[model samples]
Target: MRSRLPRLLTPLVRAALSKRVLPRVAFSGAMSAQILGNRARSITTYTEGSDLPRVRPHVWPAPSKDIMAARDFIRESAASPKNILIVPDREPDGMASGTIVSLVLQLLGKPESEIRIHFTAAGFTIFNPLERARLSRVCQKENVSHVIVLGQGARASWSLLEKSIETKALIINDQHSDRFLENTVAVSASRDPPSTTSSLLTYIVCSELHPEARETTGWLALLGIFGDLGARASLEPPYPQELKDFKKKYTSTHLRDLVTLLNASRRTPECGTRDAWEILQYTPQTNPAPTPKSIMKGEANAELRERLKDAKTRVNAEVRRCSKMPPRFSKDRKVAIIFMDSPYLVHPLVATRWSNYFDPNLTKLVLAANTGYAEGKVSFSCRAVSGRARKGDKGGPKEYETESWDINVISILREYLAKDSLLEEQARGEFTNGYKRATGGSVPLDVWMLFLEKGLEITPRKGDFPQKHALDYIQD
Candidate 1:
């Protein structure tokens, strides 16, 4: 084989002659042969295709049953002749009622003359300043003969009663079942004093959500339902087929917008009632509608933010300063509660900020002022936040219970912890015994000074808290 090989093949022949080399050459040749043989087979196996159908277009489902029910309630309320009243659980409840009432009235073809609305407010003997102003404006614009008050308690002394005797009154007791309806009948049946003849009727409406009467006399029933329930989940039947589509399109968006507008108004006192009234009148088709921008840009919001900021700054500074001063812990272990007599005047934002500064760990007992009457007793908002309870427990990190006072003085002293341990102990015992006795408790002049000094130290921030003032985040 070597003698026959050409010059170029000589190396190959020599490699083959070596045992190790011959083995490698044979293995490489086998690999090359296999690769060449499989080339066609690999191509055939790799290539494949199949036909698939196109996806169908997506379709949106119909409006939910809950939405339809809400729409029907709205439409039915609009068609009624009786003046509708909208009341919510708090301040926004008033605004929601106003907006819903106005919209429904317009839908029902009633002029401003036919509908009258009022919201509750503070003051022992007179109308709340805001309520008074609203009443004055309403009286000036329309010959308002009927006023509907919503929510649980209806104070008899509010200044709205002083208006021209011609105006009739309707009180809707939202808390108790059948109470409003019964009261309405009683008021209508009772003879008005001989002096007031212009007021013709005062009516209270309640609801079983009668479908037969809904389209025709539905407004009255819806008014009662809305007034009593506020924005609670509905238990009524789903809406009819006719209204389902429209509700699907509008209900959620509208509610979100309404909530946003209300929160804006609430945070900004400068926004005032006029701005609120304008927002209520806004419609999607209107030129100057209440968009999120419009609501935030309104003057009232700006003013409120400025005031709130000032209040916060002042209060925070005072809290820091007082915290540095020696803790005036009384001789007894019982912590003295210090707070303002007018909690309403002391904004919640400021109160919360001050509370944090005073006790970052939330170990101290801080009583904030609150306004409301319960069980025929006036109470303050007493809040306690501590690591005492777990998240799911009944008495968790924060506790809110009403502390009633018999008289303003006792309330103020108790709120300030102005009384010494002995006196405070006595006051506590008296409060436990009866609300009437607690009302009579008195604070010494020195204790009153201490309370006043503590309050005076708290300063209002120059600008509102950024979180509350920003209207973009507020829902309608």
Candidate 2:
């Protein structure tokens, strides 16, 4: 009966794609029309038009005290002969933005030999312990004076970095820091929405740095936005209007393709930094202007594509498998819990990819877990649909936008996980409410299952979780 439901809901799914999916696209006009074209008529993609969104005017923001101080510090540090290490996370956004920052320093008359990059693998300290150790050694050997960390920062890397350089390093990140360091100058706008690390850097370079930087690095900053928030057409609260404003100024498809190439460049965790550096310097006369097609045509990119294709295939197969398994119905049949063990799977994509399956007609309290990192610890992603009816005139068990579900998700997880033992307990956002789901670290799969089973035996509760602003890292 459960398997047959897909056959029965086929028409409904089709209708939802037309009525629901089309309007929610991030942009409109020819590009949107192409992507959403004839969904109501035919499902074929529009292959002709430019996949890029139309370009709009870039809005430059006024530089704040922190950005100004950062520029002043870089300028002052470059005046002397001491080397500067630019530590970038080994990901597309970090690579692209870090490269741009490197270029900016050069334009300010900083010598290439004086500038070096220590790329963190997988963009975290925990994952790149070896890399962190190596960077510390290099900083000491090379007589490095100052360090600039770009993109989402690694909390674990900070202490090591502090000891490596004589002067405290500057961190430009959008993600929340694990804890405040005593001497380090850290810039973060986690409370603000839609501002990627790259975008913030762009604003600083264009508005405060040399005039030439505005012309050369504007596009790179735009690419950074796509690299971090590519799948999103529009973002929710705290995300600045500048993101939507910036999209109007460029071809989104081109940007999206560029992001894909950047992501592909760093696909291999071991040599991601080297790959990104080569890709960054791949350009001819002008600054790097790589097209997705051009990158894909390369032998390396071809191999990367093959790997990605294989991963996608496996992931799709798993989604199907999860879909077929019926949700565990409780004694009262009010809650649903799903546990998926996908080792070595892609990060974050699984959540967005499988979210559509949380149909309102199916279940209300949905909790799902997937294996995260190789350490046996689990990453939990959640979704909640309004199941019980309200005092409405009609429309039974309909889905409506509410913070209740996200709040509840955090509440439950906090209740289950022992605070003393749990690792990486903080949400990616304020209360993890932005994505209409709460996603964060939980205990290992066995521990989570035990908690889930226990929760099922008790009555469902709300607001059981307390909000926490600052938390530190935990071993997975």
Candidate 3:
């Protein structure tokens, strides 16, 4: 029976192969053993349960013309003495902006010395004195005469605008949502015009790409889509043929990594800004492939990675310590609040690690950090979580119940003040007896408090507030 089956089906199989319409076949165990004859071992058959449809050809659209346009835009921006601000909603998004900024600067022949990059906090409240001082110092050191605000609502702070009337400022309105755009435009129009004669320009760069453009040029558009759209699965309009092709060739992870590297430079000052500038300069061009050895040997990559590793370790240690302590809300359960100082760009990792150990259902993660410099004020990042919501099945949880492992450290420190008498005394000038403090003595405290109130909104429950002078550590 087996031998006869092959004889009967040979002609049909060959005809189907020629027409590219081979019919699906199924075979049971040991029934038609001789059907394949001498080639039996080479020919395998699928059963009904098999998933043959999973096989797919790699199809990507060709590179688009818009890439070139994007490159040209960057080149033009870089050439002019303008400060470029790239703001993404998250660290990865911010990193993508950094990459775009770096590429544009390089293309415009502007050296690292002439470029300045800034990121806005998650909530857009810049009120930290330390951050303010740092921005002031950077402005002075770089002799930056212009500012470009990227992301949805980033704009030159009134203070920064007032400092030097000669500074030029531009805003790149990448937030495509009409609602967000309207809010941003209104905010900009309401602010007082800068004392400087430099002009402010706003541009709308969407996700769709234009064909005939270079890959480097199209990054911002793609990035805007990925970042602002919350990594939606569907592609957006203005979909150039080339962009579709690029998407097929590159996985989302690849694009994400590129953005992360760029952001790492800005988030980690210890890594040195020049290193980020270098990575951005090399990434956009069709340059030699970057090797692990090359990245390790590169001063910027090395410094950035080292600092990141150290910061991660520190955060892990803090989380562990907090976990061991009795829960502030419940004694028998696990309670933790992870805080990140500045936008260290490692909040997600830290949060994930903490969530794994403690029941994400029982654990509360808070992410906080600095966003950008606004009118001599430092912006902050803050988020909170609740144990009950973690265990719930709701698809989208409430804001207060959601955890932000990246809660700004500045904000956490401020919350500590609200709950601890020692911190409040220090803030109220009761700690030191009649002695004059330095210029920014309580600046840190103020920054921390603002982060807690504005960023996290973690108000104490009834009787949760600390008692007056309850803490014995209060110094005179």
Candidate 4:
């Protein structure tokens, strides 16, 4: 069912494409009614030459003191002789946001040798003990002076890591609901609609660092938005003005294709992320930059092309196998949980698929967990559907315009996991830290098992389970 979603919604997307605009996709079945009934009014998405409701006029807010400080810090650090280490999660949004900072520094006269980038592996964050060890090595060897984190969580200070890795200044750019490091310079999009993503958020601040940044980095910002949000970026809107100008600059197909390619870069746990950074970079003089198609067909990128093909095969297979496992509900029916064990990174895809299957009012949350993604740890993804479409609504899914249930998912996870006796002896690092609705952790498998026993009802695997439900997808 997860693998079939794009096919189910493709026509609506094509209809949206025909008009050279983002799709005003309508969920036409019971999904049209329940998952998003008009519970709360919010920003809207529009279609040209059609009666699709227009997005609310967004009043741009002034940059905050944190953003100004971050802006000033980057300018000052970019000129220093000491090296700067950039830490970003491997997701498309993180990569895009990291890319934006890299470009800004280069423009600000920061040399290539002075900058270092490390893409945290699948199911990991910089705060992870293993990741900290690796980053600390880089810092010690390079004489690092500062650390700039984009779209990932962190502690307020670097005191936890080896003393040598702590830089003179620490800056973070994020929009997640997790408890960010206190007493730090940071830029946050929490005040914006939940939709404002990392790359878009980073561009908002980095544009302040240099004059040419706005002109040179629009494409990257768009890529970042599409990368993180995927088709949802098109299906939902009141897209922040941060992305308004860039949206019109590129064709939706081109942007979508670019997103597919960019996301493919780090889909697998063993896949190296630097290639993605290299692939996403804006070539100095190429007119309009290298395209996904050109790069795929280009002789120089055969390895990347093969990498994408392999990732697509692995992800689609995992999506079909795990999406049908069936979910167990928390007694209150507020959370629907499914368990999977896959080496490939496909939990989010499976979770998003299941999120569309349950009744919204009954099951407000969907969590898909992969117990085999990493050793001794499980990675999970969480998603929510807003509310049912209201009376006489026909243009789009009510979810695109309705706000999610008021209880934040991250808050719930933190509330429970932080105090659970199951994790008292363990580090419990980044347990409840993640973007607003997409919450999960690379936690000890036992921690997840404990959460299941306490928070959800568990059932044994069916002996005659439909594990081969996706055998045919191998040929797809």
Candidate 2 on 223-270: residue-level lDDT in tens? 776676555534332233344555665557766765664554343323
Each model's lDDT comes to 0.32, 0.49, 0.37, 0.62
Measured by C-alpha RMSD in angstroms, how accurate is candidate 3? 18.2
**Which structure among the candidates has the greatest TM-score?**
4
Reference-based TM-score of each model: 0.37, 0.59, 0.43, 0.73
What order do candidates take by TM-score, descending? 4, 2, 3, 1
lDDT of 3 by residue, 139-247 (tens): 5565655444443332233443334344444344331112221112211211110100000111113222222224554544444344333333344221343545655
Better of 1 and 2 by lDDT: 2
- Deviation of model 4 at 261, angstroms: 2.1
Number of colliding residue pairs in model 3: 40
Lowest lDDT sum, 10 consecutive residues, model 1, at 192-201
- Give the lDDT of residue 104 in candidate 3: 48
Q: Between the candidate structures 3 and 4, which one is better when assessed by TM-score?
A: 4
Total residue pair clashes for candidate 2? 15
Best by lDDT: 4
lDDT of 3: 0.37
Number of the candidate with higher TM-score, 2 or 3 = 2
- Return the lDDT, model 2, position 69: 70
**Lowest summed-lDDT stretch of 10 residues in model 2?**
463-472
Candidate 1 lDDT tens digits, 414-449? 544433554444334222211111121123323323
Stretches off by above 4 angstroms in model 2 are 1-63, 122-134, 153-167, 176-178, 190-198, 205-207, 231-250, 264-273, 282-347, 359-412, 418-476
